[model samples]
Target chain A: MTLCTFIKAGLLGGILLAAAPLQADDLEIYGFMQVSGSSQTWDEDYGASLEADGALVGTWIDHAQQANAIAGSEMFPWQGLVGLKDNTRNDISFNLQQLNVILKKRFNRQWSSFVNFEVVENYKTDYAQESEWGSFSVQEAFVRYAPSARWTFKFGKFVPTFGNFYEIYNRTPLQPYLFRPLIFEKSVGGILPPEDYLPNTMAAQVSGTLRTGIGKLDYALFLGNSEESYFAENGRNDTDAKCIGGRFGIRRGLFKAGVSGSYDYDRLDALDLGNDVVLAIDYKVPRMRYGVDFSGSAGPVSFVCEGIFVVYDLDSDQQAVVDASHAAGTSADNTLDKSFFYAHLQYDAAKWFVYGDYDFVNDGIQPWGKDGVNALIGGGGIRLTDSITWKFQVAQYSYEVSVPHPLFGAPDPLAALGGDLTPVNAPAAGVYKGTILDVQTGISIAF
Target chain B: MKYTLTLLVLALIALRATAGVSVIAHPDVDAGSVDKITLADIYSLDLLALGDSDLIVFDLSDADPVREGFYAAIGKEHDKMKKLWLRAKLTGSGEPPTAVASLEEMAREVAATPGGIGYVDSASVPKGVKVLATFE
Candidate 1:
């Protein structure tokens, strides 16, 4: 059956089941919806030079276009790269950020099950008219068995315990800000693909907690399929390797601290330059990530912070291909070692709360000709009622990079056509810099 | 003399407004009493079982003053507790406690259901239940 038909059928089945006469305590259904409006303004000082026949040729281009071109290019995997057109541009949009529905069933005290379905970005599934911005899918479905309070096992698909916020970042009602910290916001694909930095989902998990004199110790170990590229047609491991990860933590009252680590094989359809032609090359590399996080609350104020480092182990051949196709002149060391960290603080009261967040990322590849990217965000929310909240946020991002991209100065692919190309008069010592100011307001309803 | 009497009555009213609560459980539960840390764990949905029986936690409505006092005594915030419960439910760890309308209902439900637990004002310790913890 078609995808739309399947979705309709599944929804109908859920409705019918809910309508069935079951004990209220045995079955539960609940969800939340978030709607947001955003305004973004970009300010950039970008410049590039064009050369013909190895001679200086002046080509004046719009600064906004230059920024957009570089951002949209495959060189950098920055988040929100899509739909960027100009510098000093003001773009406004209203979006249904997310709609999530959860179904939970309890079969005695030892056995239980849960399923979460999420529709994101104003998802529409009409066969006659489909939306371009939104998507619909089941985020998680799992069955859990708890023989005791301290021991439990989960089977099926579920988000494994990672750095504190990875599992709950998408649950808008649980978060105080309209936009999550940069490292955890997967919806806006950026420097760190949370999938690569942390295992996003797992098939089976074993977890437990131990109460201690000082605090409670929590631990979880999970196994899942290998990470695959976006081009992968099916949600299956492309290689024999599997992803394995675990987290361990201690909690006392409102204080918690944790360390998490994961190992996985990543398969990507990378680009290869051969005989002045760009070709798609499938490459597999082993990746390892380690992270540390802690959070605590003191009266009306609370704070949280986490740091992560990722290392990609590529063979000599794979490294050679990456150097040739991706990071030609960006860095002398093409090792792909990335790190990210963020700190957040918030003040919460009975009816309102305010928060501040700062995060930084070093995209291992350094596509922007800069050391790293930094974001500072401040936001607040008002509790309209027990089930509704209104939130607002203002975020600023800053990064520096060279325009015309240093790659253009490399062996020109157009040279084979009797044209020698080069870049002249590049920015003098880190003159090109860009900043983005994003303001968003949203309302969330939980049922 | 009239002014002094009025002040005395106001002080009495303030004292009653800040009255504490008693954590109660079904009579069959083996645990006699609990500390603040254990009480926080139970109400936060982290502690799922008491003794041999699985725990069934109940609460008064969100706006209830006794509910607020119960959380205050345990040193937890309402918003934080809500988020904790949400996380537990989504991750399949546990579910939020069922909420009743009033203290009387909370006492009745906890008394009727085996393994049930709830809290009520210190002044009203109903029959058919054992007081596990009290905060004054």
Candidate 2:
């Protein structure tokens, strides 16, 4: 059987075992649907999207997001490489948000298990294969064991233990914005995956809380295959090596702060090309990631800030594993690095909220703020009712280098034309520069 | 419209009759009372077993005013409660309380299960179910 088939069968088996039909009458079901009308102007290209999104059991799932929800999440496995890049856009389409089936079993107090099976559209192949329903992906299939109130051991597959937001991504109705910040979105395609923010994976984690004089401390240490997540793309690790990391945080009244880190090894394979292709060497990347996060809530105001840095070192050349035929040129150096920063502040008074978000990503030579993709968001939410929320946000996106930045298509035509409106594909001496205005209004529901 | 308003008024009157909530547990549960924070932790599944005894939490249907009032008294909204459990389940944490159809049904379940904990109208606390506390 193929690797994909093997992985799918194993994942299905694990979740099904956790799903062992406990009590039919005790099953609980819940989820949310985020329906929105989004209008975006990518430099000169303008379009509007009618959107319906869902993600987990109780949570919901989506084929629209890259496999990285499984990609590299504190909730899933570790991080991995990017999905196959696409540079095309469709104006009008309908997507069935998705649904989740969950079975939670509690065998006394020390042992309990959670199993979730999600069915989401396979959008990657939706266009290629017209006749397709959806497929099931295991978001969480894990058992928890607590020896004491201060100690808990989790066995089976689960999301990594990272920061605070990993556990709250699906509660969209409570959030003021419909779209994720640039930090989570960029890290997925860049070096780290967005798994930490969305889905957890098949792994093990130990977590607990302790009371102190100053505050209560909660922490988790996760050990698993760094390459295991990104399930949508079938990007599990190819070897038996393990990835280890954890997060430790303190909660003092209305404020919370924490630090988290993870380390992994990606064993690049050795490839052979008869005579013409030359030899590709196998190398192991000691990938390291570390970040700090802080959150505070003071009555009508709340804020969160997080910063993560990634370093991947290699002792080889650019052409070692990069095939010559690939479109994006290979990196010229052996050491790869990235820094991501995200912060958000919201003030809620009356029935409405005033909020702003600043997110930036810096990858190697293409440093952020120096023209890398950066996003500025200003938005608010109106609580139409307790169950329904109406959110409107304007996300201002700026890209210094235009390489198929999904929201902002890669279309640069003028380095030479002075403003007379040159041909759309004319050759240019400089890089493409432009700002994208993305305005979205969403009516979110939760029950 | 007149009939709908009349039905609404009747429903309000019925809810008022059961507005008071009594925290109930298995007859053999060790604790005679539970604090609001501990109650919240139990509902959130953060505190799995309560005070040396294993626990299986149950709740009246979300629409029950007593259940709503109990959570509201503990500084939680019904919507936020759902979101909290939703996040827990999706994130692979503990499960939400199993929901019973009504206060009577929830009381019956709590009475029979060794470690079961639930809430019901104070006036309707069934036999074999121990009342931990009564709050309005």
lDDT string, candidate 2, A307-369, tens digits: 877766555464334423122322222234667788999997657788999988665333122
Question: Which number leads on lDDT?
Answer: 1
Residue A317 shift from truth in candidate 1, angstroms: 2.5
Against the hidden reference, what TM-scores do the models get?
0.82, 0.67
Give the top-scoring candidate (TM-score): 1
Reference-based lDDT, residue A260, model 2? 85
TM-score of chain B in each prediction: 0.85, 0.84
Candidate 2 positional error at A301, Å = 4.3
Model 2 chain A: weakest 10-residue lDDT segment is A52-61
Q: What local distance difference test score does each model get?
A: 0.73, 0.60
lDDT of 1: 0.73
